[model samples]
Target chain A: MTSLTPMVAELVDYYDDGEAARHFQFRLLDQQQWPPPEPGQFFMLSVPGAGEIPLTFTQLPDQNQHWWALVRRMGSVTSALFRLEPGAILGARGPFGRGWPRPGSDQTPVLLIAGGCGLAPLVSQAERLLEMNLGPVALIYGARSPEARVLGRERDRWQHKLALFEVIEQSPGQTARRTPLDALPDVLAHWGHEPGATFMCGPEAMMTALSQRLIERGIPPSSIWLSLERRMHCATGTCGHCYLSHRYVCQSGPTFGWPELELLMQQPVTTQTPPLLSC
Target chain B: MIHYRLAELAELTRHLGRTRQVWQRSGAKEWCQADASNPPPLEAGRSVQSAKGFFFAEQEHIFEFDGRYFRETLPKPAPFALIGVSSCDLVAIAYQDQFFASDPHYQARRQQALLVGLECTVPCEHGFCPTVDAGPAARPGTSDLVLHPVGNGWLLTVTSEQGRKSLQGLNLTTAPEAMKQQRQAQLADCERQFPDDQHIRDGVQALNAGTVNASTWQQMGVQCLSCSGCTSLCPTCSCYGVQDQSADQTITRRRFWDSCLYDGFQREASQHNPSDDAGARVYRFWYHKFSDDFRKDFGRYGCVGCGRCEATCPGVIGIHSVMKRISQHD
Candidate 1:
């Protein structure tokens, strides 16, 4: 792939999920063409002067050749993206990294878990599985509160397609408040953990804890997958910014099976936060 | 192998200077892009700056965009010849050649340049090339041409077709067997003179065995100001970051050398950084150099033992100091 060249894409649609996240849909310029991005794969999105940042595909390219992403305004680039108008032109490179693995057969069940904005990639995967008529699919999503839940408008449509369990950690009303992990045992019992695949996208602590719990529940490490986030620049393997020991997150993965991530999980968490920069 | 007097070698430099710029090690620790009119002095050891930037480039515009369309900014460097590069840097260039094998920008410059390597008969201060199998003498095929100082002249061996073509018009005679033997003796003497590097060996062992504690790395991190001096001077550091700049509605995306020592190197847009701590960053940097897992990919340690990091690091956290500290921690 000619990933070094930044192709221009025009913003066609814009929407907000909450106070923290914004979603944008774009159409690639006439000269640029890319295959529909797979779930969990990402692109380096940029606006002039704000610098480039990696964003996973929230929606694959549709019949009209439009793609979408969910971006949170936690840093400079996303802040610039949040401020852009519908007609603004943005620069992008790649539909990079290996995405989530496809199911082996239509009979194989699927389980998806997500937290906060981490639900973006899982939603993409859920859409694909439902389209393929994959049997017995389920999603366990957690958020801080009902107001903070992303994609709240799509809850009814999602509930119609699969077994979706939405939980809020802190809610004011009579609705039950629980973490995704708290509801996992019943979900595992219903699906019979040995015969299905599990996918997760969330905070490191959450993923680490969930993966270990899955393993303890007799799920194979190879059958569990996670999407990871790391600082990236080249989005190709040339730049070493995203190196996790021997693997470059931009190349080897934004998605990896639990077995592949076991060693990286062992590294101690450092509290030092980097200074704000667009890169 | 062809033999030429020192003056005759200077004459060849003058000839090449007529068409292409010629660079060579001059002064105590610098390289000068000289011409026939001013032939460079024949110095020993490595130059202050590695030959990395010549091919990989410190900063390059990969592409540019106006409001309308994107244009590729591939490099088109003029033909040039580098003279008298020592073996350590030559090996590093060869290593980078493998890393950037398919990269068009690197290939653009590499294809236009000719490499002339020099065999070191004496080790320079703070160098341990032999330990990494990088020299005392230049390795075969790492350079286009290799020059061995023998007697009062030089023994020039053409290692590639490009080397033979570069010297097509300059007639020279074949050297006798005794000259080759003299070159070997000099290299052997230089290798013997390198001070013992038991500390490096012990350090690598400790790193692999997981014997070096986190507290030691934390202490070393406190000393590092993250000036990026070590990575800038390191012959094997190839990390880079990309940025875009705009003026008058036109934007250019450029890639510049980035150091892993920087705090933001592994920080995500969500502000979650894997290598956030200075100690962890320091550990990752050295781990990349000494890790056995990397050896499986690159066929050797990333370090070529040029010791440029040791000479240039302001924090004194270069390979020598870091390794020495690790080795003595227990």
Candidate 2:
């Protein structure tokens, strides 16, 4: 059986330097022991200097020769991971946290709204949906800058099954960048009219605004699921670090339906327990 | 095998002699042995510290990170008798059995431990054993042997197979009827000195009943420096952090005690901190202690009311005092 601990793996490919586009295939010499990852799961990546961080799986092919993580270089771990060469090793563990809920069926349209690096994990969701022949799927990705947009090569592969929309944060020379908040009106105008299960991820502000707008526009909170970012040290439930109220985001969710967010938004912030160390 | 009269209990340390060594957790340094005639010999009412240190050590080496490979090496398990452990800690030990021995990683150390439980003859300053229903006496089966103070000697009640073997070399005889009466009398005195159990339980309930708001936290959060002192010293708090170290062509897994009070505790890789402020940090601590889910996970309240948090707080933010203050407003 494969260990749950994060192990060192060499960086096999690099897509972009500035953008968070890198393919990490763990140095899995023995393929049989590596269990296949579920579609929407993630792993906790730990870099030497940078602390341990969470990343989602992008691809799971027939041969379990290598596992891939599509990481956006936003913080220390990803940024450090980006600097490594093809042979550079980074630590990884999991295929953790529940990913996207299984598709409902062909009758229901699948709406995938990604803001910035939010597109990283959803690409896998989109890919798996297509692999499983689950349809009809549409993707509307919003980024602060066009340069920061992810998965340009995969975009063409998904063109047949996915109706792709890449909304630039600043459509160059424009005074202000058009954030998801600004594009909400247009996104809703296009995909909002359709009745479908909408999955969203990105910065909290964008997701919060989109979720709120979608709720107001009569989208039932039950049909929408949002991926949130909370502080998580032990992506395992051990450290009270990743906890939100009674739930562990690392365990209970990095994803929650619209109905759950309604409760979370209303819940007041509270202090947490102190660290456990017996002196 | 040397027995002492009830009044002569203060002289028990004379047997320990003038050159007994005090074990310190810090490095290999040892404190000078206490003069047997100077301070009163160690009594079992309340230990200067808790039994937590015996199992869940402080500043433990979970794993070491070196380049591309990480190796996890568990410390050799140490065997020692917890001479002054209270019933509350014994119950906590029962819970620890599930946490450590139930899992493979934790069981690595727990299986090596020898638990020596003792009956509490006196109450600590903040302890309310009867209220929580965990105190004042050992629950027959939790400990290896429970030592009770008798008229002129100690009454050792052997509970487990280990208990019987531990006393093999010692000369102990079945106590007479008079000794049993004295044991009962000592227990009664402790019970009399303890306040009504209902008040402690009610106080906790009321604290739970109060509204948890930013303002309520502000009252306590201001003094907190996000230091994890309280949880570090708590006997029952069991939150931990897992780390993976990869180096030397090997991967090792590690679990370290974690606290919610620290800023990084609830930090996400995305830099979106949930308990970002002192208010949220403080709220997380109390709610985890009083909430049903926390108790359900551990099978008991995390706080043993040891007051180590009270003693170590830089701002002197006592959890009991905070609960009482919050209850007063409720």
Candidate 1 ranges with C-alpha deviation above 4 Å: A1-3, A173-178, A186-195, A265-279, B1-7
| Complex DockQ per candidate | 0.55, 0.32
Candidate 2: Cα lDDT at A117? 67
Instruction: Give the candidate number with the greatest lDDT.
Output: 1
Residue-level lDDT of model 1, residues A1-279, one tens digit each, is 244777878888988887588888988877567776788899988776778888888888776668888887898888888888988987777789989998877436788888888788787888888888868788888888776778765556788787787767877874655777776787667646443788888876678778889889877888899998888887878889888878888888889999888875544324455422111
- Interface RMSD, one decimal, each candidate: 2.5, 5.4
The local distance difference test score of model 2 is 0.62
Q: Looking at the true structure's interface, with contacts defined as alpha carbon pairs within 8 Å between chains A and B, what fraction does model 1 recover?
A: 0.62
